[model samples]
Target: MTETILLTGAAGLIGRVVHHMLCERGDRVIAIDRIGGENITACDLTEVHRLYELAATVTAVVHCGAISGPMVARDNPFLIVSSNVVGTANVLELARVRKMRRVVCCSSVSAYGNTPAGLDLVPEDVPLRPTSVYGASKAAGEHLLDGYAFQHGIDGVSIRPAWVYGPGRTTECGIRTMILDAQAGRTTHFPFGCDFYRQYVHVDDVATALVLALDMEKLPRRSYTITGGSYITLAEVAQTVKRVLPQADITMGAGPDPIDDVQARFDISAAERDLGYRPYVTLEDGVCSYADWLAAQR
Candidate 1:
C-alpha cells in the first residue's frame, strides 16, 4: 500500500533519514522543510495557510520539526514554545481539517524531564512532571493530539524517542558533537560518571518505527515510547568510542551518578507487541558507524 506522506522538518536529523527511508521504500513523500531541496516542499509550518495548502494532498503526516536540543531550548525559550507547541497544534489541526488518514508525531523523552534523583526504569503511565520548558511543550503537544484523536477521529501516534543518532547529524546534536570531538582527538568529558544509563535509538530504526505506526491497521490512539533499548550510560558510550578510536583521549569526569527518574527509561513492550518495533543498532554499533561517518567528513 503506497500512500503519500507529508513529512515536516525534512532538513532535521531524523527527518532527513526518514525521508530517505520512505522514498527508498517506494512511498510518495512530500517533504516540507524551511529549506528547499530534492524531495522537499519549502514552507514554515507556523503559517496556517501554507501548512494547510501543503497538507491537503497528503494521505498522512509525520510532524518532526521543532526546537530540538536541550541547550538550544534554554537559549531560545520562546522559539521552543512556538515551534513545538504552536507549530504542533497547527499540524494536528491541519490533519484534522484535511481528513488525513493518520498523523504520526515526534514526541521526546525530554517530555519526562530530568530523571528523578535515584530510581530507574521510568514508565509511560507516570505523571508527566517536566522540568524544562521543552519537556512541557512536548507534553502539551501530546495532549493536543490526544484531544484530536478523541474528538476528531484522527488516528495519532506519539513516539517518545531517546538519544537518537545517525548520519547527516548537524552540529546541534550532543551525540554528534561528542563523536566529532573524539574524532578530532579532543578530550570528551564524561559528565556525571560512567554508569549513567541512557537509551539511544538509531535514526534508521526510528524511521522504521514511524512507518510502522503509520501503517498499523488497529493501534491504540495513544502515545508509545519508541526507545532503542535499555539505557547506556555516559561511561558505556565513552568506552564504545575508545574501542574504535583508541586515542580518542576522552576523559571520564566525576559527578553525581546520573539520576533515572520520571520517564527516563520506557518499557517498550507496548511498541513490541503493537508495532513490532525492535531496535536493530546497539550503542556500540551506532558509535562505530557514526565515527566512520565523522572521519569521512574531516
Candidate 2:
C-alpha cells in the first residue's frame, strides 16, 4: 500500500538516505527542510502552523530534523534548545491533532551521558544524564514524545543511533575524515588519543532501523539503541584504515581520552527483539565501501 510520509530534515545525511529508500520502495515522501533543495519544501520546523498543514496529508512522520552536532550545541545553546526541543514539541502536537499512526524519531545515544568506569555498554533503561547540550536536547525530545504518547495516546518510537557515518555526511567525524583522507593519499591526524572509542553505525543501517520502526505493526519498546556490530577504539579504526589502504597515513595524539567518559558500547538486544534490527556492516567492510565511494567522487 502506498503511504504519504512526512520526512523532516530531508536533506540531512540520514534523512536523505531514508528519503531515497522510501521513494525506491514506492512510498510518497513529503520532504521538508530549512534549506531549499530540488524537491524539498523549505520550512522551519519551529513554525507550528506550517507543520500542521503538512501533517494533515501524510499518514506518518519520520522526524530526522534538528540542530545536531556537539560543537553547535555548545556554541549556540538557544538554537539547539528551540530547534530540538521546541521543534519536536511542534512535531508531536501535529501528530496529536492529526491522529497519525506512528512517528519514528531519530534520537541519539549521547542521551546516556558520562557513564562511570566499568559500566561500558548502555541500554534503553539507563538514566538519561546528558553531558552536552545536544544530548540534553535529544533527551528532551524523547521525553516530549513520551509525554504526548501518554496524554494523547500517540504511537511514537524513538531510535537512538550512535556515531553514524557514510556518504553524504555533512558533519566532521574522525572515521569519515580518515577514510576520505586515506582515499586521497593524504596524511590525517586526530587530536583525540587512541583510548577514545565509539560505536559507529553506517547511515544505511540507521535508515533501515527507522523504516523498520515505522513499518512495525506494534512497538513494544519506546526507544531502541541502534548501533554498529560493536564498539571500536580509535587505534582499531586506524588499523582498519591501514589494512584497507596500505599507503594511507593516519595518526592520533598521545594522551588520555580528552572527551567525556561516556559508554561507547550499547546493548541493542531491545532493538533486535522488537524491530529485528541487526547491523550488517562490519568496520572493515564499511570502511572499504566508504573509501570506494570517496574514490568515485574524485
Candidate 3:
C-alpha cells in the first residue's frame, strides 16, 4: 500500500536516507526541511500554524528534525530544548489534528543520559535521567506523545536510536571519524573511555525500522529502542578502523559518558517481535562497506 509520508529534516543524514529509501521503494515522500536537496517544504517547525499546514494531508510522518550530536547539544542547551521539545510538540499537535494514523518520532539513547558506573545495559522502562538539554527535550517529547496517545487515541511510535552511521552521515560520530582520521594519519581522540560499550547502527537500518514501525499492524507502547546487533567497546571500534587504514593515527582522550547507563545496549526483542525489526548489517560489515566508499573519496 503506497501512502503519502511526511519526512521532516529531509536534508539531514537520517532524513535523506529515509527519504531516498522511500522514494526508491515507490512510496510517496513529502520532504520537509530548512535546507539541503530540492522539493522540500522549507519552514521552521517551531511555528505551529506553518507546521500544521505542512503536516496536513499526510498519512504518516517520520519526525527526524531536531538538534542532534552531544557536543553540539552541549554548546546550545536552550536552543536544543526549543528546537527538539517545542518543535516536537508542534509536530505532535498537528499529527493529532490531521488525524494521521502513525507519527514516527526520532528519539535518542541520550535520553538515558549518563549511565551509572556499574550498570551494563539499559531497557526502555528505565527512568529518564537526562544530563543534557537535548536528552531532556526528547524525554519531554516522549511524555507529550504518551499523554496525546491516551487522550486523542492517536497512534505513534518513538524510536530511541543509538550511534547511527553510514554514507552521508556526519564525521563527528565515532566510527566514521576514526576511519577518516586514520586515513589522514591524524591522531583521533577517543573520549568516554576504552571500555565504554558502544553500538553502531547503520542509517539504512534505522530507516528500515522507522518505516516498519509506521506500517506495522500493531505497535508496542508507542516507544521502542532500535540498536545495532552487536555491542563493542570503543577500543574495538578503533581497532576496526586501524584494520581498514593501517596508516591512520589515533589517540585516546578524556571524555565522560554523557548518558548514565553503563552499556548503551537496547533490547530489540520488542521491536523484533512486534515490528519484525532485524538489523541485517553488522558494524564490521557496515564499516567495511563505508571504508570502501571512503577509500574512493580519497
Write the number of the candidate with greater TM-score, choosing between 1 and 3: 1
lDDT (Cα, tens digit) per residue for candidate 2, span 1-298: 8799999989998999999999999999999999959789988998777877877788899999997667455778999999898888888888888888889999988777765557666678878998888999999999999998898999999999988877777476777788778877799987775877777899899999999999999999899999987777888889987898888798887654554445757889899998999999888888887777777777
TM-score for candidate 3:
0.91
Q: lDDT of candidate 2? A: 0.85
Query: In model 2, where is the ten-residue run with the lowest total lDDT?
Result: 255-264
Per-residue lDDT over 9-43 for candidate 3, one digit per residue giving the tens place of the 0 to 100 score: 88887888789888988888888886646777787
Candidate 1 residue runs with Cα over 4 Å from true position: 115-120, 172-174, 256-264
lDDT of 2 at 30: 91
Q: Which runs in model 3 stand beyond 4 Å of their true positions?
A: 115-121, 253-261, 292-298
TM-score for candidate 1, residues paired by index? 0.92
* Model 2 bad stretches (over 4 Å): 254-261, 296-298
Which candidate leads the pack in TM-score? Answer: 2
Q: Using Cα atoms with residue i matched to residue i, what is each candidate's TM-score against the true structure? A: 0.92, 0.94, 0.91
lDDT (Cα) of model 1: 0.79
Which scores better on TM-score, 2 or 3? 2
